[model samples]
Target: MGFMDRLFAREERASVEDPRVPISSPNIIAFLGLDALSASGETVTIDSALGVPAIWAAVNFLPGTLAGLPLHLYKRTSAGRERVTGGLATILHDAVNPGMSSFDWRMYMFGQVFTEGRGVSFIERNAGGKPLNIWPLDPCGVTVKRFEGRKLYEYKDGSSRKVTYEASEVIDIPFMLKRDMLGHRSPILTNKDVIGLAQAVTKYGSKFFQNGGVPPFAIEGPFQSAGALQRSAEDLAAAVQKAAKENRLALSLPAGHTIKQLGADPEKSQLVELQRFIIEQIARIYSLPPTFLQDLTHGTFSNTEQQDLHFVKHTMRRWIQQFEQEVNLKLFGRVNNRQYVEMNVDGLLRGDFKARMEGYAKGIQNAILKPNEARRRENLPDDPEGDKLLIQGATAPLGSQPARGIGDNGGPPLNDNEGNDDAA
Candidate 1:
């Protein structure tokens, strides 16, 4: 009956009607088409996420490095695996098709993988089932589904006609698969909050500098009326702008006023530290080390070297394996495939001449690699004599005794000198 009692009764009825907690959950927001916003009030999509330098660096570095590596197709043989040439090998190593180079095609595929979380390529084959060319497909326009106990790809090629591809016809690589295995999770979308925060910090820094390195502040003054206070504030703001434009360090204010900073400066707010932390977070998302992203704030000579090894071993190896397996399965076949593709990660050591030479020397000396093989790795023309495996001959069994000359081995003795002496 009373106003307060009526309000309380209505609230109880509303709560009972809508018992669901978190009225504005992320899923709900997404359903309502409003979930692109992050807690830092920034929009995080693939394009916006790439605007962050660290993210851009990561996306480019991964695909670029992978694309530049030596890719070869090998066939199983009686003695060992031998490099295959001419058909798919030439396509994979030299060019994906007559138009695009292998590096460009691979880079395009992996760029899609990094940004959209999936990469798809259609394998065009001749009548005899020999692959003629590999064509890159836009992951954004492709939809994947499990149909009739098999995976199928429905690609929209900017036309009303949707082309359907069998799982065997496409080389599909996903950053991470969902529960259904048909869907994938994007690194940017899954970790948008962290990227959003990075964007916010970057925007803040830009704005701070844009206003002539001035932080937000308030003026505390003795005022007689609201209008006077307003006028004084406007005049003070104009003066500040003018001083900034003239590159003047000192600011003049009225007698009764003092400027109070509204927020902590960048250093006090730990902006640099936050930025470094953000780089680490992004690195974790990509399984890359901060050093790979050129974050050398904490890098030392020894640790940087270790980071390089970590990148090749931990980060790059997994991606290489995934890509190799995918291409091999689609291009060759899943079962009893004699031919396969491989990326020679040894190219990463090309820059470190000493390390590379030492590794090659060890491989050659241990008979694991022929001298010509090592020379080939260095892109040098091979010599005919360097084709054989070479190893050091100094090593022997611990108990073995040295073999002396004929006098010690029960062979012919040097009897002339001793016999002549006895006769004399």
Candidate 2:
């Protein structure tokens, strides 16, 4: 049987039971589309937040880059650490289960983390406690609570009944935990106002352009009634649209009415600048550089490279460490487990040929990495002579070599006293 089938195989086959009472209500606001109403009068949920291009770019970039990096499992040994193969390693590095590749699973999990604020997974193990497979769980369907000092995960598994998993059985990672530790704070909910403003600005720009670059205006004339005034306004709007469509430079209005702009135009209100500022704000939310979001207004070659370093060190490293620790704790015990999973963040440099080659050269020359190992990184076939550590011959210990004369076959010159005594 598959992991899920075996997990629920023991439950009764009768009618589905009622869901167990959780410690508190599940955090389903993101999925339910009820996060919060922003100051711009827009409802900010996961969907609305993502509708903003900057937010979408940030979310997609973070999760995509992170998931695409290499993930491997390694075992600690007497000589050193070596990568583990087969079994759990295969599940982690290659595929989580038969139905899911490791990259897709990680992308899904991190996507939820960025949008819904939490990502969860369940570990399926054989009889000997050796992990067999890993299965992802929807955060919206899972509720966490502490009972009798132990944390429990109650998941709604598509039945009327809720399946319970101990903390040890679940792998949980939250963007940021609430004070209760049971609930997580979503990025969408936390920064709804900023994202809402972005949406409002985008919508306003679209509407403004849709009206043929004509801002809303006030029609001034001596009208007999409100009906007359409304009709005049509509007529004026239609004339403006017709003129725009016809590529006419002049808009023909009624004899006595004049069009007076009601509000500031996009240029006057600095719409472009506002949109750029919004992108910067979203970047801050994700701890990303604006350059990564395709904002190059202020990007320079030097600073852009610095931003890349910042992303790896300040942003991506934190998530990588968090995921590593969570998987380590879940897959192995806290105590004496020698096996653990690691994400190779250095994989990001794969696209930079110069950087990759330089790093490999340094590693091989310093004997920090075997030549075969460096070649393996580039997917090159290993040579028999490349398996050993290599270093420069000039790097030998200072006192290890004897002093040599300039022209004595690398030995001290013949002693003059001995040669002269024999001659005397």
Candidate 3:
């Protein structure tokens, strides 16, 4: 083959045999001593697949948000926030050790659990038998006992030693698909082809940038000595390499050489559409609007706000509810008047300043929130009149009907207004 032909061949080979592809493929041989997820054999593992832009955006967004939001313990009525002194609240707010705060701990654990389909943690108790510390167990390390009921956890200790745990000994929060007690079923395992295709597209886009997003160019030359020709080729190659590295949009070539571009234009190949399609597929897995995954080709000012609301209501709600229920179940179990945890998702749904302030004003006008509370929320100094719940003039409180006289319709006295004439 000619020099140009060999060069193109090498490029094709490099793209096809990318190291990012999993080991189970015919293109790659697995390392003998390697330990990797079964999912990794098909596509990238969850760890590597997270590097996919859409996946990273969705995954990091959830954990970070949940960690940052104000999670309070409240009664079933939700009238007043309860002060949960010890037990899970302390551990949730501060975590077990200085190595990780509650935010870091929850984010890490929740991220693992949500992505992998389950998160197992050991709730260690103090001398008083209250939960002193909560430590996460690697999902990969724990195996569920199908037939054996009492001995549920067959956990692989760090050094390969087997340590068995009873059902009560560990907290198993699973994202169940069907009847499986163990949360073994995951998207990585079930939707291998879709995820693999996504990874391929992601890798292609990355390589597109890494390879400088430059279309292939060729040089056609006039006759010169073999030595001169070789020297010219080397110089051209070096110049191209430099251009690629620096991301220079313009290029200059040598004299007596005609330049011809190779490959279809990005639009012709539908590169954007392909990436967006993959991103939408990923969003489906997470129950998010494609906009939440940053695919906003069709986004508008009106639709963008709606999309943000949809994300909070549809996407964020699902994950938040899951965490709330799991925390309540694992922490308090079945108990009367159990204080449950709830994330303040109202802030997320509330719109911009004008919309939010108007909503708050309406709340104050309707006596739902005292003006002082609204002022406090807005960081404004409290006014004496703001302490009162001021209702709109046209509206009246429910059951605040005109009082009836004694023995009137066999009821109590309706003498609330003595001077005014009493009318039915």
- From the highest TM-score down, the ranking of the candidates is 2, 1, 3
**What digit string (tens of lDDT, one per residue) describes model 3 on residues 263-348?**
76677889878888878888887777788777788888899888888888787788788777777776667673657777777667
Instruction: Tell me model 3's lDDT, rounded to 2 decimals.
Output: 0.66
TM-score of 2: 0.85
The 0-to-1 C-alpha lDDT of every candidate, in the order given, reads 0.81, 0.82, 0.66
TM-score of each: 0.84, 0.85, 0.68
Candidate 1 or 2, higher lDDT? 2
Which scores better on lDDT, 2 or 3? 2
Q: Lowest lDDT 10-mer window, candidate 1? A: 10-19
**Model 1 over residues 1-424: C-alpha lDDT tens digits?**
8775653342210112332311211222333445678889998878888999999999999999999999998989998899988877899999998899999998998898888788889989889998899999877667675554567777766666678799999999898887756677777877889999999999999988766788988889898999998998888777777878889888888798999988889989899999999999999999998998999998999999888888998989999999998888787676855888899987685658897889888998999999988888878999989989889987999968454455675766455554355565
Instruction: Give the count of colliding residue pairs in each prediction.
Output: 0, 0, 6
Q: Which pairs of residues collide in model 2?
A: none
What's model 2's lDDT at 132?
A: 84
lDDT of 2 by residue, 243-306 (tens): 7788777876668878788888789899989999999999999999999999999999899988
Pairs that collide in candidate 3 are 403-414, 404-413, 404-414, 405-413, 405-414, 406-413
Off by over 4 Å in 3: 1-42, 75-81, 85-88, 96-98, 147-151, 160-162, 176-178, 205-265, 371-390, 393-424
